[model samples]
Target: MYDIAVVGGGPAGLSAAVQARARNKSVLLVSGDVRDNPLYRTERVDNYLGFYNRSGRELLEAFRSHADAMGVQLREGRVLNILPVGDTFYLSIGSEVEQARAVVLATGVARGRKFPGEAEYLGRGVSYCATCDGMLYRNREVVVVGRAADAPHEANYLRELGCKVTYVSAQPPEGLRPDIPFVKGNRVEIQGGRNVEAVRVDRATIPCEGVFILRSSMAPDDLMTGLELENGYIRTGRDGATAIPGVFAAGDCTGVPLQVSKAVGEGQVAGHRAAEYCDAQQREEKTEDKERM
Candidate 1:
């Protein structure tokens, strides 16, 4: 178990990991492909404090190098869920589960708005995690609305379960199963009656039993089932503290200017606070053991 688990490998996440390590706490940094971050698409960033007219790629590389030099353990995967198990948090990452005393969410806001009828039909026929719900649709038709790198894999997972999976996206997804039927729709909507009945893409309608909306980053509220959210952003204080005791949030996921500077500062505070929280939990547990003795 790590003392702190920092999600997202962008500037904020890296900063958090580095700071937590500086506090002598064991840190685990979980992230997907760095390029998946919208920041990587930026042509150039000119307003950063130290760097002037630096390409996003260059700045990101620097951030990564610094984290690596600091001995931060980086794990590559998207976090599916965060559950509070007693004093620690259990993070479902891709296919693995990791335990951490404290967690810092730096997942940037690549989360898009829900499709029409999507929320209304959730659980009845809609899902955010294909892996979590794919088995239920075995041998049945399903539509996957993918906007992240893992969409193709989720589609394939569904197909392996004997699901007749049709993938819908604005553009062709990388690493998608070539055999799965692909639909290119810039704007797709869900149509259902009691349960999901069809997916409308432009003028075409494809019937399906379920629809899955997959994104690069899980929304904060979705990641931590009962976490508080304000206007779709994780509700956080200046120190990145959240309603959940051990779970803190920083970066674009917290809201506002969405600048690297703000993220870095928030990360520093979050990491420090998380380290302190973990240390306190450790001390309390030790005291309890002593009392028992």
Candidate 2:
């Protein structure tokens, strides 16, 4: 298993991996290609400190180069699900699953604005990641929460694979010309406790077996069912610790003042702490072995 699997290729994730590796810990960066910091689309990053006039893309390229120089393995694939088992975490990436001791999510903010219990029943019923849970709801009633090419694309997929889908929108899903259950309503609420029973809409419960919460684009939280997140950000303490052990988060995903300097500072702290924790575990095991011998 990898020492750490940094789940997002953004500034925070990249910096964290480097920090961990600098301490002699092996690191693996599991990120999709487009996740290399969307700020790269912007014209300038003057407020980012040191880079007085750097383009987002240029800075990202430099960051990537640095990560590569340090021998961090980079894998390309959209993260579909992150399963935490004991001390290791498993990431589902399009027919493949990767395991790691820790994960740092920097997948950015999810802004689909399609609400209520959408957050509550994330794993119970509302799931943003289709790739992971799509199979579970085969030929069952499933509602996908999203718009743009991403949402409809997923909806079409479910439909193609024989899922009864309702495209509930924050806004109408774009470019999807599929024959499926497309419910045009907001305020997506998941009703039920340990198991999801139905999705509450404006006037009805759109009775379904499953609800795929696709809000906007993917966030670090959406991929990890048990990771507590709110408003498209991965909820973390000041120390960057998440509800999920061994998984740390930083930067905008942890919420705003999303400056480059802030991300770097948080990344440093998370890196040091995670490394220390992993190191301590190793030492404990070594001691235990000696005692047994």
Candidate 3:
């Protein structure tokens, strides 16, 4: 088990891992494969302390390199769930389960709006990670909701999984490659109460075995469950503590003041707090061992 496992490759997760290591703890950094960040491509962030007018990507890369230089072990995996076990935390990352003394959930959200029945069929027939669930619908028709450049690639991913994909768009396909059939509409609705029975748009029912929502923007809670969220942000304490012990969440997960610099500062505090928590655990283990002997 690692001393700390940070569940994001974004700004906050990276910063937390670096500081945790500085406190001499074993660190594992897990991230989704969104290497080409969508936010960095558009925004011009000039309020940053250094680099008066630096692109977000330029700033992000520098931090990534710093974490790499510090010998932080980077692991690529999409976290599905995080559960607090006895004196340890277990993270369900796709097919693997990782245990760590401390956990930092820095997975920034990839969700837009919370629609009814959206979370009900979470793993039933509806899924988020197409790569993981696409195989189940092999040779069957599937639907993708969203009109970003990611639509084509997501469709391709489903195709590679041996499933026929139909890209559903809330808007007319713009600037995107025009190879796949883009079902253009204003609002894409998933028509069902409990499990995804069908997708309805203007009295038209498009039947599908599965539905994958790929909306462009994301909010904080879009990543993990079992957290107290207030206005789409993870709630935290003055000590940077969360509801779960040994799971010190910081940055956007703790919500509010969602800026890069503020996030980094919170990360440093969480990292140190996690380090202290781990150390206390180790000392307790030693005492227990002595008593056993």
Candidate 4:
């Protein structure tokens, strides 16, 4: 188990990880594919303090390098959920689970709203992870909603698992298996009664038993229940502490101005606070053990 887990690989998250490591705490930095990060595509970033005129990719690489040099463990995957049990926060990363004493959320803004029946059937017949639920739909029909860059690869994995996969997205998918049929549509809706029956992709309604809605990041509230939000952004204090104890937030997820400098500064505060929290928890546990003896 790590002392702190920072979700996101952006400027804020990298900063948080670096700060936590500075406190001599073990840090785990979880993030999706680096290519999916909006900053990675930015051609020029003109405003981040000392680094003027550098491409976003260059800035991000520098941040990542600093974190790596500080001994922060990096994992590539989308965090599907965060469940707090007692003093530990259990993060479900795709099909795997990681445990941490404190969590720092830096997930950038989650684009788009939920589909018609997306939330209602979340666990019933809808899923966000292909690796986590692919075997359940083997030999059964399922619709793969390609929203993230890696969605097509995930859809391909499902097809290999014997699932009759149909790929749907706003634009045509690159690297999709030729045998897997692709549907072009942006306005999609999920339809079902007891379970998922079909996915309505604009004008077309394709019958399916399951639907996988893949996106770059899950909203802060969706990641963990009881995490408060203000005006669609995570509610946080100046120190980046959220309503949930031992859980802090920073960067675009907290609010806007949405600048790289803001993210990095907030991340530093969150990381430092999280490290302190973990130390306090360990101290309390030690005290309790002594009392028991």
Candidate 3 collision pairs: 111-218
Better of 3 and 4 by lDDT: 4
Off by over 4 Å in 1: none
Scored by CA lDDT, what does every candidate get? 0.88, 0.74, 0.72, 0.95
Q: How far is candidate 4 from the true structure (C-alpha RMSD, Å)?
A: 0.9
Please rank every candidate by lDDT, starting with the best. Answer: 4, 1, 2, 3
lDDT comparing candidate 2 with the true structure: 0.74
Candidate 3: misplaced stretches above 4 Å? 33-39, 109-111, 146-154, 170-180, 192-195, 201-204, 214-226
Q: Which structure is stronger by TM-score: 2 or 3?
A: 3
| Model 2 residue 85 distance off true place after TM-score fit, in angstroms | 5.5
| Top candidate (lDDT) | 4
- For 80-182, candidate 2 gives per-residue lDDT tens digits of 7789887778888766788877777766665545467766776787775677678888878887766434567778888877788878875665667657656
Model 4 TM-score relative to the real fold: 0.98
List runs of model 2 lying over 4 Å from the truth: 31-41, 75-98, 105-114, 119-125, 147-149, 171-208, 215-247, 253-256
Candidate 1 lDDT over residue span 1-293, tens digit each? 99999999988899899999999999999998776887787899998998999988898888888988888999878788899989989999865799999999999985677778977898899987766777889999999998877778889989888999999998888888888999998788899888999999988899999998877787777778778888888898888899999999899999988999988889999999999999899999999999999
Q: Tens-digit lDDT track for model 3 on 1-293?
A: 89999877777878888999898899998875554344356357777687677778887878788988888888765676677778988877755788899887676655456555567777766776666677889988777775344556777777777776767776664444454566766555665655677766555667777888754333544544566777766777875667667777777666666678877778888888888999999999999999999
Candidate 1 global TM-score = 0.89
Candidate 4 lDDT for residue 48: 87
- lDDT, residue 97, model 2: 83
